[model samples]
Target chain A: MNAIQIRTMAKDFILKEFLPGERPENLTDSTELITDGILDSLATLKLVAYLEKSCGIEIAPDELVPENLNSITQIANFVQSKQAST
Target chain B: MTVAALHEYLEQSARRYPQRCAAVEASSGRQITYGELDALSDQVRDHLRRIGVRPADRVGICLPKSIASLAVLFGILKVGAAYVPVDSLAPPARNAFIFNDCGVRAIFVEASRAETLRCELARLAAEPCLLPLDWSDGPSPLATYLARVEADGLAVDESARPGPDNLAYVLYTSGSTGQPKGVMLTHRNGSSYVDWCSDILAPDENDRFSSHAPFHFDLSILDIFVPLKHGATVFLIGEELGKNPTRMASVIAERRLTVWYSTPSVLTLLVEHGRLDARDDHALRFILFAGEVFPVKHLRRLKAVVPRARYLNLYGPTETNVCTYYEIPQTIAEDRSAPFPIGRACSHVKARVIDANGRDVPRGQEGELAISGAPVMLGYWNMPERTSAAFHVDSSGRWYRTGDVVIEGDGGVYTFRGRRDRMVKRRGYRIELGEIETALYRHPAISEVAAIARSEESGVSIKVFYASRDGHALSLIELKRFCAHNLPAYMAPDWFSHQQLLPKTSTDKIDYQHLMRME
Candidate 1:
């Protein structure tokens, strides 16, 4: 999938799973999920699982930093990079 | 120097190690020495006094975990007042309820949250004075307030200092009722636990402790105070880094943290996602876990990676504060599946297993665990009836009912069976299913609701089953929003199931067992 499609899918999953009842408009692509307390440790792992399974990219243990998963755009970028390397 | 109050630990440490690092922000690498922390807290105490705060008063702290917030906490205690810390990330309404329930005269909060919290408090009858922790615009910030008071050069009133019996802090826990209840802890109660930990851990000024738990959690009691009592440094793990296991692992190695205390879930995350096997430069000497049971599988794996560190399982409710502890053996058999026992009572406290009649149960029999000692809280905040009901009085002494069912194993070791009440531990936070149900009942559309907790491999997940009043379908988003507004995020239900009618027993009570079976 393209970068836009990846961002849309991840955002949709996060909205449906973690931030139910939250307005989609409120969650910008650059919104800091971990810092804003929207996603906790468990939720972060779940999001990682979704990305690895759906995007067909393996995430290394060291790659689980905030720079890669803190925002929807960051997640999409990380996923694209992983896909490109593979 | 003899320590009479909780803040005295910091004072004594400052006198001994003025230039030693006392606190460090893990994310930003900010450091504060003992002298700075002591003087900063003194400024906060002066600011509080200028605002007419006195001994026995309640002050609320709603800021994130940082060195500044820690100073504010010690300042509140120095003024002989109890500090009530609410979750900065929780709903404003919940925080407002806690402030009102405790009748806080003043609150130190983030400037961004001050307006919303002020509006929520306005809805209630009480209007607490809000002192923003940080601000660029609007009301004067805490720094400005403290600086103005410092310029006045007012001397602290030593006569108004708190005694050992005076309250140090009030931590609110989930109540079966819709509202939360504050557990009132005094200087004596806090000192008992801290002294016990210090004696056993034998920490020195060179030790670095990781402050992984939030300020509001009971685990933070050890994270902040124990190290201060020994002139050690506490590394404040910020919220963003706290959720990232990779970053947490890196912080442990990079900062060379010698002491670590947190829930089992956090440690599990580190073991699974942190790549612990890759690093070997850890300076850890003690690893303590509490709040919930640590799975044996994860514990085995963790011990394999960091075999040199001593592991301990500390057990207690917030009302008791580390009344019991167990030292894990160096080796576990590969076939072992059952979790280790909670072990015996701590040196400062006496723990016993009693039957329904409050009489001591025979050895090896299951009974409720009751603790009696200096570590037990004085009582719930302003809740005389609850305080009385929570304890059992006899000729021996008063004992606080823990509501935890356990069995006495070999050699006085107590093995946890389950909770006698509807309370369940999720990620080390005690949650009452009834509280979730009560929050859901507040929604106008929810006619009947029952909340239940299911133990999963990841941890406990709360599922709420509800039926609408008009038989019309309710949106999941709306119900979830309603719950988020009323309860803390941890207490929010993970799943919401719509039912035409909730199953009930012949006595008209909801059949919780039936719902569990369905799941």
Candidate 2:
């Protein structure tokens, strides 16, 4: 999966994990994930598994951080940025 | 509270209720009678002694909720050693930190957890023998340890000889510091708390107790030991209880449980969504809640269900082992929070609300609480400086700071307001302010820092507000690195809010609450 695809999947997972209700398949850019309590604690843990399996990338334990895995946008940007640099 | 010693008490109960049921693992549908709990605890105790686990040595217990775990806990106490209970499900690194922090001599784990338990012990530079749970009465590794180690002989005086002065158990609690602090307790403190609880719950031979809290959490001290001391049976609810409250409610009613101990949040979940009918469980006699507040609305609904069962609100931190408690009057349960109150301090425990300067505050003025009594812990294990700071001597060296704000009310009743200190609790873990402050100050772009706990997202969160330096920009990575450098994983703030200048009160002290609300 590409960075965009992974972010969309993570957004979907967070929505289900928190709200536990049906959601739109295509998330818009203006998704208020944190403001609406969509993504919460254990975000980094959930995202770690998803990213390692989906993008074929490994997350260093020290890399787990709120800012780095706070939401779909930051996560996608982090993945893309890391891949680009590597 | 001149209760019989642990072994004597269990022996008496065993003789009295030989055929009556004592322990049950609902997940496995395995039940042990009072006679069985007494017998198994004795076996575990004797086995432990045959090994070299001398009396008063720290023994770590890492296992899931099961009959073996329950038996080992009581057995450890029965033989006179303090058993440190660690939740098997918690992060292995965190558990490893706790094991290292306490310098536990040995740990008993199930076969499944033995690998991880050994790994943690190895990281701590200690060689703790891993005793598996599948002993099947066939070469029980623990049984072998009990048999082989000469030092693991009988408890001092051939019984659990811990008077009020000995360390009962050292519970490792959370902080930003990588090391967790173990709060030491004594047999006397536990018995005092249990004495009050047994009297309040009035558990009889027929009463059945539902154990919900993990053995590690102090709440279980009452749920597991109280029943054993009272000769009542305990229905050991496992991790399955966390998955579905309805299933657990069924266990309570189906098993005819007579006593329940859990957090207010769990009871609300069961009542509101699990559709629990408290009245249906006629066998249940008491419901005790600690670790959080029980809202007034839910109290009424509970009364409507269990009209005969008593509902108690228990309050205290790990150090105090549950000090103040209120037995819910049925009228208050059916009415409003107004009729409810934080009850009087337990027997022999003295409570005083004091100010920041350590002066006793007048009634109705919110101030930090200082508690002095048998229940105050022996201070944090291995952190003498931090322990001394919190556990201090007044003019007479008689008081321990509670860090909680309370107000004196009519008839010696006290009401809780908020905390006077920065150590806040979220999801049942105590957080240290200094840890977060140290983390925030590390941001290269930050010149000064203050972290405070504020209400957020339906729970408590660390609101870290810092003053930014003029030339540098505070990158998110920089901030994360700063916290990751000096604090424990949990002490890191969930949210960071930057400010040009921190607000201050008239006395030049940081207005922490005001700064918290800046965002």
Candidate 3:
């Protein structure tokens, strides 16, 4: 999938799974997910599992840091990099 | 074996291994040697006694985690006074309640918090003398106070020496009635568990332990005392790094921590956010967890990361100080759905699942878990009625009712089912649902209220559903603000829902399960 498609898919998955009660309008493309407490430790793992299963991308241990998975845009970029490198 | 007095352990260890580093504050990298810990604690004890601190009296320690805090703790025990720890992060009102309820005569606070301590003391009905410790600044007010005392030739009283039965510390836990209840633990109550830890973890002078849990929490006892007893080094993780998983993993790697103990929530955070598995360092050998259930999936994943590290799940409330433990198997089957067993009882403790009649339940049946052990707390501090209600006496001995439901498994093992009361462990804090409800009830507009813990795969957070009184319209923001004023940040409900009428059962009692499902 393209970068835009990846971002859209990741954002939709996050809204549906990690933040079911959150409003889509309240979240920006760069809104911090981990630091803002939107995705706690458990939710972060669930999101990782979702990305690996749906997007067919393997998240390395180093990539699990907040800089990579902190926001929808960050996650999309990380996924795009992983996809391109693979 | 009867151990020496708790403070004497530090003295003895200092004599045994004076050159070994005793502790390190992670932020500043300041280290305390065993010899300094012994001598400094003696100095603090003399200072405390000079200030009329008598045996059996309560002394409050209200400083951030540092060398001074540890010295004050050992000094309190040295003088035979029960040290009451109040988390500086908690609201002043909560700290005030603990100080008042425990009737502390004096408190040791950080220099930065001297004014806040003064204000809190002023609000109390009785005043507690404040002794400030300056870790950053030189010649603080506390240093001046000590110098003045010395110059005046004030003689220290060396009369009191605490024995096993003497109160070591009183940790305050969340109470259902909105007031915090102090769990009075004696020196014996702690040493009993420390002795067991000595055998289980088997640390030596070479070992370095990571102190992650906050002082107010019971898990801290293991982090602080266990290492001191063995003449090992303790790496103190500050609150900021303790909450952040990436920093936590980095510290463990840098310090080469051999023994790691914390709540499963912290481990889950490190495993996910920090990718704690990525570290190739091999210092960690023992991984101990308590305070909440470790999700099997996370445990399995962590096991994969540190395959050589031995994993153990310890089970008990603050009252019993860990009477049962389960060593996680090397591999958990992918098809297994049940939570791992809580394993067998710890040394010197008896654990059983009993029915309503206090008799052991049949195999595979669910019942309340009761612990009878030497490590059982003396009782709730100054609250006889609550203490009596928490324990049951029979021909055997006093059994502390855990209020936890467990199902018996084969080979004398038990699997945790759930708690029988409103108490729930969220973010590793044992919070009472009634406590949150009481906080919400303090809001004048709240009429009917119910609080429930919502658990997801990651962790648990509380949600409260409430209705305003007649003709009162209460907004969620206003209610949250009210709760913030009365409750600790962790005790405040994460989500709030407004309702015209709270759902009730046929008997007209609030249906908590229904409320839990509502969110």
- TM-score of chain A, all candidates: 0.97, 0.66, 0.91
Prediction 1 TM-score vs. true: 0.91
lDDT of 2 by residue, B1-519 (tens): 345344455667788878887778776677777776666677777666656677788788887787778778777777778888886755565676777677666677766767876786687787865566655544334444445543543433345666666767777776555345788888777777777776776667777888887888888888777777777778888764543555676777788887888877677666764558743755667888877656677767777777787788888899987888888876763334453566788775888877777777888878777788877888888778988788657775567888787888887787877776557776455777765676556556678778877754345677677788893335443455445534544455766666678888999988975875576
Write candidate 3's Cα lDDT for B1-519 as tens digits: 346467766877898999899999876688889987776677677888878998999999888887778888988888889899988867677888899889999999887787776787688765898887775665233344456556543434452567888899999999998889999999888988888999999899899999998899999989988899889999988765676676688888888989999999888888877768789895999999998888888888888888888999998899988888999888889987567878888977988878877887888999988999789999998899999999878898889999999987888788888988889998778999898888778777889888888777767877778888883445433454566567775676767677889999999999876876774
Report lDDT per candidate.
0.87, 0.69, 0.82
Steric clash pairs (candidate 3): none
lDDT of model 1 at position B462: 83
Better of 2 and 3 by lDDT: 3
Candidate 1 residue B60 C-alpha distance from true site, Å: 0.6
Q: Which ranges in model 2 have alpha carbons more than 4 Å from their true place? A: A1-13, A16-86, B4-7, B134-160, B176-178, B277-282, B332-340, B392-397, B427-429, B433-452, B456-515
DockQ of each: 0.23, 0.05, 0.07
Provide a comma-separated list of chain B TM-scores, one per candidate.
0.96, 0.81, 0.94
- In terms of DockQ, which candidate is stronger, 1 or 3? 1
Classify candidate 1 by CAPRI docking class.
Answer: acceptable
Docking class for model 3 is incorrect
Winner by DockQ: 1
